[model samples]
Target chain A: MREDRHVVSVRDIPETLDDSALIGHSLSEPETFAALFDRHADEIHRYAARRLGPELAEDVTAEVFLVAFRGRARYDRSWPDARPWLYGIATRVVSQHRRAERRRTHALSRMSVDRPATFDDRSADRVTAEQLQPRLARALTRLSAAERDLLLLVAWADLTYEDAALALGVPVGTVRSRLHRLRAKVRRALGGNDPFAEEPQHG
Target chain B: MDDEIRQFAEGRPPAPAYRPEARARARELLLAEARGGGRFRLPRFGWQAVAAFGVTVALVGGVAAALSGRPQEHLAAAAGATQSAAVAEPPAGDLEPRPGQFILVESDTMYGSMTMGRNGEESRHLYRTHRKIWQSVDGSADGLLLIEGREPRPWPGQRELPKDAEGRQSSLWTTLAACPGAPHRSDYTYLSTLPTDPAALRERLYTAADEKDVDRDERAFGAAGDLVRETYLPKAQRDALFEAVKGIPGTQVAEGVEDSAGRKGVALGRTAGGTLTQLIFDPATHMFLGERQTVVDERAGQAPEGSVVALTAQLKVSVADRLPDEAATAEPGGGCPSSAVPPTEQPTPAATLSPPENVTEGPEPAVTGTMTATPAAPPAVKRSPSESAPAVPESGVAATETVPAPPVAPTETAPEPAAPGAGS
Candidate 1:
């Protein structure tokens, strides 16, 4: 037990020390750990901003990677891709700051009218993306927090509902239903009979 | 629905990385905690205690993949199999396809545990116990139901329910018809949406039904436990469950696979967690078969996965007996209870103020060190002798005996005695 305590101690360093050994180095190596943060900080920052807005985004992003690094000891080594795990943590962090998130989204929607194209600046190949911002924001506000989270994670993060479920820690069934309800609501809001406007429409 | 909304939000590419210096500081903070020298420590769980918790109900039942766009025929087959396993034999060709789809459902059945000890018994025993039934109808849900087994009687802590005319329990139909999205009507017109508060939303549904002078909200309130509990789970946990299932190792859309219902559907890949989740749908109707979630939690740093948690169920769009009521098509004026009616019809927005009034006031104000506020305290302190003694040490110690009033009058009636060494 004494030896085990020392071993655990070496594994449990603070932010001042480097714990990143990638399975085979002295846990004291800080440079190894810096590589992980350098890789994820900015993308996580952008994701935080997109979900929570610019002001709260930076802090939330920092907190996210900070958490990820702290919890890295518990990570399953068999899993190589860390994006899903990071996303899962980010989802909760975003939720904790929900009020801030809502206010930001509301503000963004209001501004979307001026820069409608920026929200969905898909290539000129698609005409609908250009014209849909005002109507989309209105539709966006009608959705429940859960609904909006599921939708936006997919659009911006490009995660499938299944991947999203992992990021969200929810069953896929919930994801599908939220999407369905949200799509229906948006269609009703927009009065857009264009089948493609809704999800999984059979043309 | 979630997928559709997400598709619309299409995210941008990753942002540029932060400079190396910032990354180094963050690395140090995490390592300190890792070394156990910082403020954080990982929570400890006894291996036996973990085993005793049984499989997490949600993790086990989440084996059912939430399906989309499946044939009705396949759904009937799969649902029939699952139901038959739990209950009686299912109906034949009851597997026939139908319209609409299964939106979502609660995945797990959580059983509460209890430890009982005899008066003189040295050892207490814990047992696996059953509570309520919860299932999600579709992938986007957490617990499909909030309540289980028999209508709950009202209690001190009981949540309020909506009721119908004749003082009966109300349902989804009666409440939604006249309410115009009563729960969320406010944001709806501007964004055309509904409110998210379950209680407020319930009231809106009730108000809509009451427009006909009916008491739907009241009736629903009576049976609310059944309505909401039918899908109860903490909102945050539910969200987490969605994220977890999505992260299961190796989860991907399979081109062609047969689900429990034997429907030809796309497969979702597995995850490192060893949970297999897939979506099966009918090409013809786009109806959904419930999800199949297979979960395994391998012992950390151990070679073998320890246990298997499997939960599967089916969700279909069934005709709710209570629907086609006013909630489906609430025409104007059909439900306005006399008191609630006037404000609703005039096209003016009705103010739905429903917060409790008796918010408690805070404790007496703390004293600030300002000289201007000192005079006000003396009079208040003097009136209450008991308080003044402890409050004003300077004045109390100076006056040994009771003192008379210090009066200065231009037209003097009498010379007031200076009590307690006043003359000295």
Candidate 2:
């Protein structure tokens, strides 16, 4: 058992390297970049899927890694985690399909109003949230492309304000202010229900 | 801390499960770029970007070819040819354009267009367009491309027309500059200078530079298609082109293939990556019709197998004395910077020999036929494995004895340096 553990540890060494270190090594050994893909492709795909839909998520995921691999030389080595940089490229790629995004949001805003009534076991709070979906989707369609990008980068991608700002190539202050305005607008659209007023109550 | 904004995640349409094939293909493309040992340049223009999209789809189907160092040998071993024995005499044409005359080509085309949403959802459709181009014979003056968008059709499995594609029927025109040092590739004078012998022409076709990330055989096949598609080739050159295509290792014949214009014709096709590009020819007359590309294998995040991703139908090819007056009033700087005109001469204003109305009213020629014949015996050329096994009627009248030797070493011919910003 101890001998097997030693062998496993040795094999796991390359996988343990930070993105910055892996990127640095990839300059000399291009295959090392595959580690980055393996590490982040799923999360990136999920985030893109949430934004664009599954069909386009595949392309977005592929394009993000390709763009990242090609631009690895210019990757800021100081940033240990590559998530922000990857998200930044994803943001740009998603922006190119603005029309499709608008259409998606518009479609969501039109989801049937009686949908919540169909499910009996759902929690009251969950039901309320479901009902707000139409308003929320409509509100999303109204946001500027940049605002929508920052909102989704935070809400969907789970990026911090700082990381979201990095992904967007904006100062942290901009992220804060824009997010603040976006929350207020969303709150108004939800009829004064402050989405950030309380911690999320459900998983 | 998470906010109610996270609630939007619940509203997201369920994303399709990530396919491992997509991941592998993307990784391979990156590794290939890395192995190429340079900064990867994304295609810069709209059409080139579309071509790149198709290439990505093709790569998904062509993993075996991509992995091999010798793509030509692998492809040659895999490709087969079926030749029909009924030879047709080459069509007669006095296609040579006089000095100052423009070689006008009008065609209808439909190509795949993909758009991804901010949410990561994408829609695929075929964007259709009608194009009219006027090129100077000697590359001494400006050329014009008058393109009008047509209705778009959804790809297979797509239910509704993409919202963004709605109301895209707009007419736009671009000028092809004929400046010194940057000749239009299809300039008649240069095309007329090409060798008319099949063997020599085949060598020239093989020696042309490979398109970025495309294999030598694929590039040669595409070059052959480009030479005949929109440009007028005199009888000798056209005859040689058909014969030269036979020598290309992967060239296959498909019987009863219909072009975009609904004209049934015999097709000579080649597969690269995952796409099958067929250059359709009139079966009886063996006249060039047009070209179409079909997806032969399942592509990642793209059209399904058997989808016609690209299609073109040549409507007319004629000579015009001058470009329309609209060419004179077109926006400045709209012309391609790569003009073919000499530095010493000022460009003469386009002479108004005919009205624009007259130019647009030319009757469409009918080239309709039911191409049903198949030869009982294959030609004497070497054969390999092919996707289309149907035997085609012999179209080209070239002698069967002169099959050129297999493609020579790529190092033998230097790739012609591409002119900057040249439109494909």
Candidate 3:
């Protein structure tokens, strides 16, 4: 009976089958979690890589999915979108390697010290407000782990406060509060206000 | 601000490189464990036993605060019994403050964490945070928060304190009274108006947007914790909150919890998010003592086993007629200010209880950190294999390769995850 049905990859599962359905499917067929994996791995991996590094990013991304898979039995079917849940797992996974991430950030800043974004990627330099790449990396490193996570999730991961709350297991209010705090910190770190702020340039 | 950061981070030299090998390795390990049937099962019994023992001590503290001989049963009631009757009557016969006044709670919180600095230097440390809140019981929804931090005894890699222009250690005092971003007036009154009947309360809280999905009992308990922490409620409602909380499954009385001011009290412990959150109470008077969150199941959390993630112990909770100290500066209440804050996020016990129904899936693909919103286990659905197994292994290796066809097929439309779509 088991052999009669072919094992389908995650993509084959209908895109319409939101996260909860796939999770439900995974309950019967453990491999079904892979579909959930395929949907979000790239983003999760990117987030992790940005926080930590490519090496740990892969491991952290893998761990996030693995942990999610192992814990699928407890996943709330109520949350059809798995991004918050996956990111939450990814956060925990990243939190475990805090030192490594800090080191990597420092390394990145150091790596960029000689040739700022101005040298390597002119486009990136324009977008980042022309601050030396090291300064941006340093600013990130200057933040607490909690602040960094919130900032990057919003900045890099592009999660809203509500999604961040769901992912972090805190309340939307708390997310708002953290983001408010983070913005202040960012302003302070970047010599007052966002370096790439969009106000019209002065004469 | 976020856009700039995103742009800046993206502009850096190399884009995120996905690792096929790492994913493969993790996949292999998971598949092996999934098929192995008895791979790694997180050992919960050890923590539960410790929690039970610790709870006994905390409950004794609660009993003392309650000045009641009946807390042992209340303690037992917390063990997932769903004591519907307890909703009408708290286990302890404690007195409540007279209505129409301010209730001031002052306490110190200890947060232990491992810090990784910008230069990649990492170390473990402990810091103490102090808090004072003056919440009015009357419907105006007025409140005050005076929070500050004191450097704790140093551990390795602990950093120095950062102060404000006034030479004050990092401090925040916010006043609340129907201010836009301040405490919600409805949050208080809405919670007050909930049905007092335990079962009905469970239905009301659980059927709400996000609450509907998670384990009903835990969500209810978490919600109760939120209401208890955030605002000052009338005695009847307070009792109702506890009664509702007591009915949630998996709650047991933590015997004794010493408040930050070193006062003894009773506590209720619920484990989630890889940490055991103990809602401490005044043992003799049944008043709230701040809570203590300890890492119980570190396998999935940010800390190691037994680490004290954060704990708040209340020093003073008094029913006063007015703002305790109006002259003292408070953070502007209407809109959250863009002020420098101590880096750590204080865990507001009541904040966790808010409904997540308003949030919807948007174009942004990002994740926030949410520890628990576990869908209440459906009657037809099989509990996690580990939950059914009375004897979970040390590493929770119980996941098996063999599959059991779930007894019922889901007839779900597969709504967006953030759409407040009903999972059931």
Candidate rank order under DockQ: 2, 3, 1
lDDT of 1: 0.35
Candidate 2 per-residue lDDT, tens place, B1-424, comes to 3354665655443445677767655654455344331211111110000000000000000112211122222221322211121122233324334445566666666666554343435455767676767777555577777767776777766777877667666776766655333322555655665668999788767655323334667667766776776677665676787878878888999887765555556788997657788998766545676677888876632567887777766655655546766687653222222122334654332432222323333222111121111222222111121323322323341121111111111212424333322321
DockQ per candidate? 0.07, 0.12, 0.09
Error of 1 at B223 (Å): 57
In model 2, the runs with Cα more than 4 Å from the true position are: A1-203, B1-92, B283-286, B331-424
Over B117-154, each residue of candidate 1 has an lDDT whose tens digit, in order, gives 22311111111111122221211111112221212122
Question: Can you write out model 2's per-residue Cα lDDT over A1-203, one digit (the tens) per residue?
Answer: 00000000011224446789778766644555766887888889888876777667877787788678767878899998999999999998888777777777787689776575333436666566556566678878767788889988887787988999889999999999998888777666666654433444453
Model 3 alpha-carbon miss at residue B412, Å? 36
Give fnat for candidates 1, 2 and onward, in order.
Answer: 0.15, 0.28, 0.18
Model 1 residue B299 CA deviation in Å: 24
True contacts kept of 2: 0.28
lDDT of each: 0.35, 0.57, 0.49
Docking quality band of candidate 2, CAPRI definitions = incorrect
Q: Find the candidate with the highest lDDT and give its number.
A: 2
- Provide the DockQ value for model 2: 0.12
